[model samples]
Target: SNYSEEPSRHPSLKINAKEPFNAEPPRQALVSSYVTPTEFFYKRNHGPIPVVDDIERYHVSVNGLIEKPKELFMKDILNLPKYNVTATLQCAGNRRTAMSKTRTVRGVGWDISALGNAIWGGAKLADVLELVGIPKLTSTTPAGGKHVEFVSIDRCKEENGGPYKASIPLSQATDPEADVLLAYEMNGETLNRDHGYPLRVVVPGVIGARSVKWLDSINIDSQECQGFFMQKDYKMFPPSVNWDNINWSTRRPQMDFPVQSAICSLEDVNVGRKGKIAIKGYAVSGGGRGIERVDISIDGGKTWMEASRYQKPGLEYIADEERSDKWAWVLFEAEADVHSNAEIVAKAVDTAANVQPENVEDIWNLRGILNTSWHRVHVQVRH
Candidate 1:
């Protein structure tokens, strides 16, 4: 393992695993800023981080099922049109710990912080694809390409030590409106090694797994990449489908996440001075959907109250507003009287009117991925 080369991490992160360095920020710290700091952003790696020291020698090969195959150098890519897109990338396995408690499921034991919103600066993938002779919004290449696969330089155990890889539909890749980027900068600065230093793929509105870090190449394939993460791991399965009777091919890989929100102001259980308790958290919907509203339930899911949400502080957040960032998460805040012990909950509705299911059991899967159930916490009011 290349663990020796791993970069130092923040002291505040709660380490869920040591080998691949899977960790998330303290819940309170996560909601402290509109744009999560680079140091505080959650780190999710399947294997040892790859160290790329030579920026001049780095190049991403773009080929397979295209009219012109080209190995684009780093300098060539930098000269293209640059766009800074604010997007949220959430892990499909986020909140797996909550799902695992229901019934032991597989994969990383993440809390709520397996996601982050950042200003990703890079060349639009649609523009890069054009340089390779494929026009924008062309679903299928004339030579029969259907998917755009991103190959990473990082090797993971899931692939039997092969490099990490995944793909998106070629149509999504070609649609400049999709905002897919070959990102080299994050949060207004050059990306650190843990966040994919030299180059990476930032597929806005998709699960984090599809945003391959340390990108090595791009392939326009006739079908999606047959990588382990794409074919075996990230797909959601019915609760009844245990490892014994599981069929990996039955369901497709998870892309856009459903409407999800979490209250981060208090811990799972908190004892506070009796009075009004302020609640704060974040709400995000995938596929470029905006959060229409966030509902807070002080008496568990018995009843609800609307919470105020915003992306930039002090500015009104209207989901349908033309100037609002469609891909970023909106922070939600609310206040409620807490005279006694209470069960507090929060759930979000996307612009599309998609509401989160109230119970984890209703959406429980064998893989324990996409646990977007209502977030509930207990508050003990000190009398």
Candidate 2:
């Protein structure tokens, strides 16, 4: 059960745990490097790592409210034409620490490193669904439609129950922009067992939790999957609510990530001498809106400077450019001259003009969902 084998980690990654799979790259990992290699990328798993020794026998089942219930063996699924997409897989709790500072939240305590960007290669979910007799949407979908749910092949015994499953709205499932996939390869190679060996659901723009790993089955229903992940966990609450006053039924699970950014350059303890320093990190917005700009402030939020930009992963194609569809993180860098010791603050604004809230306390919720506040780090300017 020891799944802590270090694949290929960036020297800059900050270790959080060595077993059961937990670790984060420094914030700079998002900005420092353009393409996050598979080895050094952050790995988040909720159960015992399942090792898939054979792909030949691997099969993915697609059922529920469909004209035809079908089972897709690996060969059959792969035989169809293949499509590739570059996407950023981010854990909904990427900056849980920031939320925890305001109030205690439930679930895996992750910092900024519980995310990674990769070029996933597989048949598009839409294409596969068509083969299975699901109709493609030609116009706006009717309201009150049921949701689509995905379950992981990697199962675990729940403390109070049987198994764990995650679900997302059918709108997200079928959205053309959503570009969800039944991914078999990560970064051009077979997926690592720890990441999800035979298959996994890649639900773009939503949290990593909904992108269930080791995907076993896909179900379309008139209601959201009543699993713990959908009905009980990952829900957001008002700022005034606390553990003692929780109203679980009234809250809603988080679907999209709020606009967020972080500082990746300097660790918490290291202080650079007073001079010129480069600040870099990544910013992304949920619901498919691209990041517009990132603002950096040395003295809290009093003054700000725009960070330098890099091209998004998939949308643009420079001759020498890496993956053009930036479903992954967008790296940004800004240079500032340090004159005196001060606290550095960083906030990102997305193309939608959605900016991180000024303070975490204002947005603090019982479950700690959507904690997009200005990222601040204190450093000394010593000469």
Candidate 3:
């Protein structure tokens, strides 16, 4: 098994594959709380988890278009200022199963649970860039760089025997508001091996692929990373472009995801009752955009009702307004009267006013990369 060295995972997660392990929490378990517990958090791995027996000896290198390349050890990272960011990490293939129903697509068949929000503790990437002698982060461009690339230590056979890698634009990387971090701790505890034990890059409001796990090195490049993940894969194409006639180069890599929402309620049958049925789910947006409102429908989009949004458990709102820019997700719920069998649906609007597509067929693609359609679930009113 490719995951022979992988650690034991929580039995609650719905395991999608045994090797190159991929699993997600159940829908009900997902929205049970605002912040997902580390144990119950979804696990998405592209390749074998690199074995780092000695975390103390593990070092990350920073180079490319810099005055001088430097390697930092665990001790060096701890000395830097630690920032706690509560952000959601969602797989690009999240909700791919729903898209598959519309058309045959290639990739992991992930449900809506392939995402989880948590508090990450680490040093900001911008601060680290400054520490590495990049005096002007916002104004200066290293060798006229266009993107920042991240390379991981984990090996993947899909890439023809190479480490997994991805990249983001230089402007987003240098943006102080990006809240990009070299995360060492997750949810107030040291990250386990499955979750990038020693360190990993956390790019807030971007696709999870950009936040490279088991981070090895970072580079400033005049062009995007030439890795297979950056060039060939993770790009979205129109439904017209199938395997027979597809152009990977024509489509751009998925960076900021669109506004998305999912109905996390699992229970369907309401026995001997004809009253309000409780509905709860999660909504999120990418690129520093907050969710403005989430609307719920019981009769398949005929009428809609606004659901109340909740942040952390005790706090009605996130105390850190600065961190609330677009990192975390909002949980919503509504109690609507259900008199008969009907379809429950949800759609979210981001701060940019971007609403999710009504049907999966509308946004269907070849790779099933981003399926952010209005989530729906059928409910039966049983006597």
Candidate 4:
């Protein structure tokens, strides 16, 4: 496997893996701003980072179960009505390290920052599907066309050296409200090569795996994508089912992540001078659900304080608002008085009332995906 062509990344990024190139921003860098800097955004790749230089030759093929299959070029996509969407893309395996502590699980070890929010600029998938003769809100399945698979240009060993791919329901793809984008821009700038250059899919409110980078081809199918990541990996299995009893067929592909929150201000164990300390971090939920509340417990889980949540600068954040940040994370902040050692904890509740589990053991899975357990950090308050 050749790795000489990997793009240069920010020096501050904490490297988790070197081969497939998975790294995330430091905990302090995550809540620095409402929108994550492009350089600081986490890089999660399955294979070698692909580079797209041929602008004219680069095109996305829309085929499979469509009436009019078409190969759309850059100009063709640009001609469609463009929209900018602000959404957060989080890896399903985010915080896998914490889950592994309970029992070993298989997958890359990711910290608390394996996610980022960005303003994606591109043509809507609903509009692009309309170009292929599929109307918006295409829910009814006539010819068993229910799923939309997105194939990528990046090659990974998981599929025996095949391109990375995943899929979503056709109804979700055709829903303009879903905010599925064939993104060519990130944070008002042309997407860097590290992120999918030229084109990529930005499926808001879903796991980052569904948003295939390095755009290649779009396939409409009767069934969900059968790719390695979709079929074999990213499934949630109970603790009773180990590798021996685990049957991939028993579970479906994991999609939207659960409500999650973490305190970025303190380390795993912080020795802070006895005083009122400021605690800040990010809280988010999946499937278009907004964070309803972020509860902070500085002295273990005995007493809790509701952290003030905000998305925009100097403004209160209200979940369920008809705003673009609905799919984005809310930065929570609070001040707590700690006279001695304390166990800082952060628990988030989505607008749908989905709360993070108090313990990782309850939701522990073999794949180590979606570790939405309450984030706890031990802080040693010194006098």
Please list the C-alpha lDDT of all candidates, in the order they appear: 0.90, 0.72, 0.83, 0.89
Tens-digit lDDT string for candidate 3 (122-147): 98887777766765345446566667
TM-score of 1: 0.97
TM-score, candidate number 4: 0.96
Write model 2 residue lDDT over 1-383, tens digit each, in one string. 33444344455656665554577766665665666677667877655676666777778788777667788888877876666767777877777777887778766677776777777777667667676666565222243335777877665544243345777766556655567888898877888776787888887677777877887778767777888777777777778777787777896777777777878786654577888887887777776777888899988889998998775443233233333364555778888888888778889888888889998888887666666788888778777
Per-residue lDDT of candidate 1, residues 1-383 (tens digit): 77999999899999999999999999998788887888888999989999898888899999899989999999988999877788888889889999999998988899998988787889999999999999989999989999999999989889999999999999999999998999998877898999998999999888999999999999999999899999998998877889899989988988888889999898899998878888999999999989999999999988989999888732223223333268899999999998889999999999999999999998888888999999999988776
TM-score of each: 0.97, 0.89, 0.94, 0.96
Return whichever of 1 and 3 wins on TM-score.
1
Runs in model 4 lying further than 4 Å from the true structure: 313-323
Pairs that collide, model 3: none
User: How many Å off is the CA of 255 in candidate 3?
Assistant: 0.4
Clashes of 3: 0
RMSD each, Å? 2.7, 3.3, 2.3, 2.7
